[model samples]
Target: MSRAAFYDQIETTLDQMRETGLWKPERLITSPQGARVQVDGAGEVLNFCANNYLGLADHPALVAAGTEAMGEYGYGMASVRFICGTLDAHRTLERAIADFLHTEDSITFAACFDANGAVFEPLLGADDAIVSDSLNHASIIDGVRLCKARRYRYETRNLADLDRQVAAARKERPGQVLIVTDGVFSMDGFVADLGPICEVADRYDALVMVDDCHATGFIGPGGRGTPALHGVEDRVDIVTSTLGKALGGGMGGFVAARQPLIDLLRQRARPYLFSNALAPALVGGAIEGLRLIAEGDDLRNRLEANAARFRSAMTDAGFTLTGEGHPIIPVMLGDADLAGRFAVRLLAEGVYATAFSFPVVPNGTARIRTQMNADHTDADLDVAVAAFTKVGQELGVVS
Candidate 1:
């Protein structure tokens, strides 16, 4: 088609999305992210949609560290790592991450998306293969697509299916086989069975990689993530996670792995090679965040209590919720339009949550994914549950 026709077609698709209630709109947060935030049009509301699990986005210590680093190291790197972008702060943050995750070494990226995008192509070749969870993040899907390695997929978190897929991939006699999955599936809030996954990988002689973006700073004991949670930290081969969630809630991603894998990515990961180094402020804050997380049993306890409170109350009120023993609680509303409407009504009731629909999730699995933070109090949990209950009753979602 000609350029004009192509543009018109794109517009038509957008219109269809809006009409079908699949369009997602952004809310303006006038104040810093925390349990309570000021929305530009809606005023202050209890925020339940953020990934700020530890509630450190606006913490005083993180803010001070970031500010101090900016003053000490200047603002931006203005260059890539190999081209003089590597700052002492960068190395410090990477070391902190490796020490935190108990990995040999780690490499930083602009975001976990880039980390996922950069990982596959450098390590795997045409003679190799990747067996991925069916519901793995889109970045993993795209990363796998970019690699020339043969690909196989299994049902989400299904060990039997994974074993089958690995067996099939090995049948091809590939040089290397990697099994990858998300440590925590963000949409459903379900933690992967890492212990079992490690068992499967061992049986098949395949390496295991986990994208632990959602669990890195808060899921496991000492907040070491799912591998540690499952007592398989030494077994899992590679870990990719984000500093954007729970880790001061700034923005950066990294891959923690054995020394050789990290060394290879440092030399060849395009995102790290091409993107400007992380700002000094983010690095400094992340180091402090890691420190806080290392000694944050209190915060983790509070977070668990908040999640348990919300889940119990919502379930008792007759809302169908997904996931367990994790902070993410997705209130399932199968209809995309109904989910959107429910979120709007929630805002009116002084709760700030967003509806998730197709493309972000499967077509019939739309939900309002609520997250709990350590900063939230019992009163905040009560208010959120009340809002959800009222909205559910009004919309005939609950009795």
Candidate 2:
């Protein structure tokens, strides 16, 4: 195709996005990820959209750890793990993660995206089957598509549907069966019904896998994640998570499972075998983050308190919120245009947040997704609540 045709096609698609109100614009942050940030034009605003659950994104300890690692291990690895990229810090972080999660072994990846992308292709084949939750993360969906396994999707958080799906999958008589879900759905903050799911999997002799990216380092006692939260730590067969969120808010991911499974992944997982090793600074910072999680529950308690405060205030302000009292609180607005305007109004009122609409979420369920963090003070929450209240009332979303 000619360059002019290519340009015209791209421009037409961009026009369609703008016309449909689906165009997403990036907000430039002049400050670090925290309870408050400075946007490019907006001087400063309370941030309620970050995934820094434990307030460690800008923590001094993580900074120190990253700085120390830079001095000790230098900068980039320049090669993948299978080559000469593996460092002592990489192995140490992998082992630390395994110990933290009480798993037999673990393998690091460049990101949780890669970890999820590579997991299914290596473990399951044409003769196997995968039973997934309807609302599982997109990465899992893509991973399942890449694999040759027969696929089945159960209704979100519905055990009866899961049972039906698993039973149906069993009729195929596949070599192996795996049930996958996110520990905590990112958009709605609904914790997966892992206990029931595990029971179903056990009855059907299916393996259970959880992507605990949103729950790790903040959910459950000792922050061991949703498997522990649901009393199925030993029952979950595979776990994948990221260091990009609560774990110091850096970048990297890992898959934790039994020794043999991790060993097989190391040999066959394309993301692990082909991607460049995780940076040393991230590995070191994450190791420190894990240490912090293992050391105390103060951060977790603070985070939970913040979430409770925000949820209660929002509910009291007469806004409908989806899911339970978790950090990810979506204040439902229903209309995509209204949700977009609500977010803009929020930013103007000194609260920074983003709205979700169709394609990202179901239609007629547009909402402003607010994430609470340990770093947010009572004053900060009050400020955000006031903003929401004012905007919600002005927009006639609340009485």
Candidate 3:
């Protein structure tokens, strides 16, 4: 096709998206992540958006650690891990992550995106079976798509459907099967009912895997993660998560599991073998992030308290939010135009929450996904709630 033909097709799609209010305009962030953030041109805004769940994105401790790592280990590891890249700090960070999750061993990746992509093909063959939650993150879906395993997707959080998938898999595939799900659904903040899923996995002699990207450093008793929350800490076989979001808030990913699996991933996973190693600074910062989250009951507890307050206030104000007690709260708006308009209005009123509509979520399940942080005080939360109520009622989304 000619360059003009390709350009014309993209322009036509962009126009279509604009007509349906689905085009996403990127925002320019001017400040480091925190409760009060400065957007590119906007003044300081009350930021209810961002994945800084524990409010540790720009913490002094993390900053010191990263800065110190630069002096100790230098900046970037120019080579892949297997070739003159893995350092003592890399080994220590992997051990710290494994210890934190109470797993046998752990392996690092460029990002959790790479971690998920690394696992699917190497572990599961065409003869095996994979049963996945339909609401799994895009990374998980893509990983599964790349695998040769016979794949099956079940309803989101419907334990009964998971059981059905397992039963069908056992009847057909007879042996190797993996049950995959996200620890918490990012779009709706809904937690996976891992206990029941564990039961089904156990009954069907299937292995369990979870992408803990959203749940780690925020959920569970001491931020031990989703399996810990469900009393299945040791029941899960594989756990994958990103350091980009909650952990370091910089960039990196890891997969924790039994020593054998970690060893195998290190040996065979393409990303670990091909991609440039994580920056020394990020690895160092992540080590400290884990330490802080371990001793961070004060910060993590405050985040939960904030999420509870927001969920309760929104419910009392006649809004339906889909999620458990996790901090990733989605304020359901239902219409794409309404969500976009609501986000723009919230920005105008100094609140920084984004709208999730078609594609990022199911069509008609548009929402204002608000995240809570330990740094957000009750007064700031009140401001957010009142602004939401005002805009919601103005939009006639609430009575």
Candidate 4:
């Protein structure tokens, strides 16, 4: 109980969080993860809180592949890739990701969290510099911090701020500069304009990397990613994304890039050196998921259609959404308390969604973030949208 002198402050802060409407308690799930889920004490609930954009988690073919791999390779690796954990399936998944991303080579990690953790430091040093977007995912921020490189942050996708930042870097600390950004900003559903960013990077002779966690499966032709959508797939040198998002809803991540960068990460990334490799069954399932994308992404097409329908209806209903054309839709409520209340009311109406507030998002810009999946039918979206409309008006968020 007395592990640290600051223990009482932890309880004190938690109490404060409850008072401020920031304290969250997770609910128990009584059914499988899918388009609709059952809560322990509640009835059937439409899932809008998950990152399962492709709805591939419960596909029969993926399940079959996973089960077969389990039979072929057992349960766990029990060791890191440096040891006996580097199975043929793991290497195959890596290669599969490279082919999907149109990159030269790739590497696998336990999660995209670790892929970013292992990426920066091994590739850059104190003498080098990292120029990152202000609103990049926390993983990339932590990765840059773990490295000794000088850090520079540009305003999120603002060309003026980007130029200002680049100018500052060139004027003050001239070295090998690297630019980092998310292919799609998860919170706002805004895609990075990689064409212009690449032009800027080329001007500065800086390396370019994108974290394509949110855009990998529905952003470009055949869902290549934001870079491909922006017509600069060849300009992005490295990309990191999760299999758990659009590919498979299990747990795995990957880094795809040229052969030299891949070789360097394999040789020196700390997380790669220390962590247990991905489970063989999951790796095999991810390989199958990639194969499906290349063969024909009916899932991706359905997801786009769903996003368009929901966004159009929500906007017509007087609900404001962030940027257009992405499955991640943010319903702005402005007050953290109200957003939380709105989420509860929607849940009671059998629609499951989560509210974002301070630290996760800006304090006054609180919102209920809804993610669409390929499996959500027209009727399902209409039902969810009706729930939102009702709750929104009752809460004064619309009309």
- Give TM-scores for every candidate, taking all chains together and pairing residue i with residue i: 0.98, 0.99, 0.97, 0.97
Q: What is the lDDT of residue 319 in candidate 2?
A: 94
RMSD of each: 1.0, 0.9, 1.2, 1.4
Superposition TM-score, candidate 2 onto the true structure: 0.99
Residue 27 lDDT in candidate 4: 90
- 7: Cα error in model 3, Å: 2.7
Poorly placed runs, candidate 3 (over 4 Å): none
Residue-level lDDT tens digits of model 3 in 1-399: 999999999999999988878788888888888889988767889999889888778899999999999999898889998889999999999999999999998999999999999898889888889999998988888888888899988998998888998889888885599999999998988889899999999998899999999988877878889999999998999999999887858898899999989998899898899999999889889999999889858988888899999889989988879887789889888898889999999988899999999889988899999999889999999999899999889999898
Candidate 4 local lDDT, residue 211: 97
Question: Which stretches of candidate 1 lie above 4 Å from their native place?
Answer: none
Instruction: Please give, for residues 1-399, the per-residue lDDT of candidate 4 as tens digits.
Output: 566748888989999988987788799988768899998777899999888898888878788899999999999999999888899888888888898889999999988999998899998887788889999999999999999889999889997788777767766665677889999999998889899999998888888999999987767998899988998989888899998888878888889999999999998998999999999889878888777777776888899999999999999999978866799999888888898999999999999999999979987999999999999999999999999999988988888
| lDDT by residue (tens digit), candidate 2, 321-353 | 997847999999899999999999989999999
Candidate 4 residue spans exceeding 4 A from truth: 1-5
Per-residue accuracy of model 1 over 1-399 as CA lDDT, tens digit each: 999999999999999988978677788889999999999888899999899999999999999999999999999989999999999889999999999999999999988999999999999999999999999999999999999999999999999999999998998955899999999999999999999999999998999999999998888889999999999999999999998999988999999999999999999988888899999999999999999999859998899999999999999999999998999999999998899999999999999988999889989998999999999999999989999999999999999
> Candidate 3 at 64: error in angstroms?
1.1
For candidate 3, what is the TM-score?
Answer: 0.97
**lDDT scores in order:** 0.94, 0.92, 0.90, 0.88
Give the distance in Å from residue 391's predicted Cα in candidate 1 to where it truly belongs: 1.0
CA lDDT, candidate 3, residue 64 = 95
Q: Which prediction has more favorable lDDT, 1 or 4?
A: 1
